[model samples]
Target: MNPILEIQQLTHTYSAGTPFQRTAVEGVDLSVMPGECVGIIGHTGSGKSTLIQHFNGLLKPTSGHVLVDGRDIWAKGSDIRAVRFRVGLVFQYPEYQLFEETVAQDIAFGPKNMGLAADEVARRVRDASAVVGLDESLLSQSPFALSGGQKRRAAIAGVMAMEPDVLVLDEPSAGLDPRGRQEMMAMLGRYRQQRGATVILVSHSMEEIAANVDRVIVMNQSKVFMDGAPREVFSHVAELEAVGLDVPQSARIAALLRDRGLAVGEDVYTVAALARRLLALKGGGGVC
Candidate 1:
């Protein structure tokens, strides 16, 4: 089956034909299968943001093609606006974009943009708000009056209301606290499961991506440095570190134990997984 999204030889240059011109993404070939969750990790200016922008026609590639479901997104008169509805993008600090009079209106913005019926829009708004855990009463309150985290949830709901087939989020939990971040991720996971949508998340946090994504793509020097499952990608610790990324904490701890002669599994990444492996090493007893 064809992938949900495909990018071939994609390149993007800022300030083209000028002395200060610099390529933010170069010759990047990537694909996301239907219903797959992919995570992208890179340091600032590594081009991750630039790459995702191409997925939904937010930014046209300078010299390559971005295909959505086997069709070039830039095909003549290609309803790029419809593409945006099909591939919802949640930008970093999305809350800052909320300008509606109330949370319900904010959440309905995307669906309304899609020209949905009034009843359908209302239903979508409530469903999306529930996904983000926004209370029913809060829907009537002005978005500007909500707290930072609440505002963020409202904005995210705005995108969720579109029910996009491919959800692309750029640092969805960037400024949230630990609990808030965890909650946001859980909500996103639930949404992905319910819709069976393809998810592409861009984050600087190795731990978050390691715990959630089915595959991880590492970006470095404006190109794809590595692409594989979490275990496969994290196995190359040295290269990742060189690219300003790190393996998950549990992976590092497991490595330490292996270095000290413990038979810990090198593939362990999650804390619970590592703990289970270590306990098994102790013959079902407590940590040795």
Candidate 2:
């Protein structure tokens, strides 16, 4: 299968030709296939945000290229604005960017920018609002009147209204309570399933990545430190820790149990999987 998004040795240097010039991302290469959900995790200032900005032409590469569907997005005369509609990006604290007077207007902003018809924009607003769990009653209210979580939902609905083939979220669940985080992720999952969209999630939470993504990409020092399935990547707990990254809690606990002479596997990164492993060690006895 063809990759929906591809990065070829991409590099981005900030403030080029100045004394403060520094490379945020250097010689990084990666790909995302259609309908796949991938997570990117890194320490602060590890270039995760810089790297993703290239996906939708938000930041032009200093060298190399970013390709969307076999075509370089930076090719001469290519329409960069069209790429933004194909790859929807929701930044951290996106609620701060919501400026429309009404929730519905905010959600319709992207679709309207794409020059969609009135009927089509209205349909997108309704569909995106429902996907994000926004109520019709709130459509007429100002975005600032909503709670933090509701504002976030409205902001995300704005991007979803564009019906992008690839949705990229950076720290999407930041600052939310556990329930709110779960609800937000559930909404994204539903959106991906319904649209068959490829999802790229950039987060610092190992548990969130382990539970939701098909693949994980660990970044360090402006490079791809590790890239693999969650189980595959988490199995290298020592390497991850060496680079100041955390593994999931279940994986850490399983490692501790194994150190104490238990037979738990290093690949146990989920709560249910760890529980089952312990149960099997107890000869399949039921736990109260």
Candidate 3:
């Protein structure tokens, strides 16, 4: 299958040719397949945010190209706005962007802008609200009146209302409580399942990536550092650490056990997998 999104030798330089100029991303090549959940992980200033902005033409590349379904998004006469509609981006702390008088109105903004009929927009609003677990009764309430978590959901529903083919969320669970974070991730999972959309999650948490993504892309010093499945990426714990990124706790524990002579696989990054391995060892009288 063709990739839903592709980046080729992409580079973005801020304030080009000026003393304040800096390259946020350089020579980055990546691709996202249809219906795949990919995670982008890196420390602050590692260019994760800059990289994702180029996905939907939110930022024009200083060089190279971004392609959506094999067509260069920046090609002459190409409609970048159309690309944006196909690749919905939910920014970090998205709740802060909510401004409509009512929750439903906020969620309807995207669809309405698409020239959709009012009824269709309303239907999308309802569907998106349900997908994000927003209460019907709250649709009429002011967005500011909702609690933090509800506001976040409403904001996300706004993007989901567009029903993009690819959803790009930057720190979707950032600043939420543990339960809130879990629910947010679960909601995203359900959205992907229901829509069969490609998901690109940008986050700082290895645990989040380990638990949610099908593949991982690690960025360091404004370039692609590693790209692989979770097990493959997290197995190189030392290399990840050297780039100021942490592996999941379970993977770290597995590494510690291996150092102490326990026969555990280095790729065990999830809690469930780690627990199963320990139980198997205990059953074999290797360790309890």
Candidate 4:
């Protein structure tokens, strides 16, 4: 099967050709398969944000191409708006974007814009609401009146209502408490599984990426630093630290334990995984 999203030699320069010009992303190449959950992690100014904007035509490449289903999004006559619908992006703090009078209206915004039938739009609103775990009773209430977590989910429901083939979230869990963050991540998992959507998650949290994504892409200094399964990428702890990115706490501890000749696995990245490995060692009398 063809990749649902592909980027080739992509570059984006801000304030181009001026004294204050800066290249945010440079010569990056990557492809995301349909139905895949991919995580992108990097330090601030590392270009991960710039790279994701190109996924849905929000930011056109300064050079090279972003292809959705084998077609360049920037090609002449390409329907950029349609591309946006196909690749739904939820910006950081999406709750701040909510503005409709009611939660239902807010959730229905995208489908309505897509010119879907009113009945279809309503159905989508309901479905998206359920996916995000918003109560039906909340539909008639003002979006502004909802709790912080509810507002965030409602805003996400707005994007999901579009039924995008690819869901790209930039810091979707930012600013939430740990429980709220876990709930948001679980909601994302439900949407991806239910819709079979390709997901691109951009986050600064190694724990979130390690626990949630099937594949990890590391960005550093406007370049693709490492791309592999979570275990493979997080395995290079020193390299990640050198570029000013943190490895998950579990991964760091596991690495230290391994250095001391413990039997914890090489691929431990999550707290649960590390706990299991250590427990197994203890059960076997390998740890006193």
Candidate 1 C-alpha lDDT tens digits along 1-288: 789899999999999999999999999999999999999999899999999999999898999999998899998978899899989999999998998898999899889988989999999999999999999999999999999999999999999999999999999999889999999899999999999999999998888998899899999989999999998887777777776778888888877787787777657888888978987888866458
Residue pairs with backbone atoms closer than 3 Å in model 2 (clashes): none
Question: Which tens-of-lDDT digit does each residue in 126-189 have in candidate 3?
Answer: 9999999999999999999999999999999999999999999999999998899889899999
Mark the regions of model 3 whose C-alpha exceeds 4 Å error after superposition: none
What is the Cα-based lDDT of residue 201 in candidate 3?
Answer: 97
| Model 1 pairs in collision | none
The number of clashing residue pairs in each candidate reads 0, 0, 0, 0
Question: Quick one: how many clashes does candidate 2 have?
Answer: 0
Per-model root-mean-square deviation over C-alphas:
1.4, 1.7, 0.9, 0.9
Error of 1 at 226 (Å): 0.5
> TM-score for all predictions?
0.97, 0.97, 0.98, 0.98
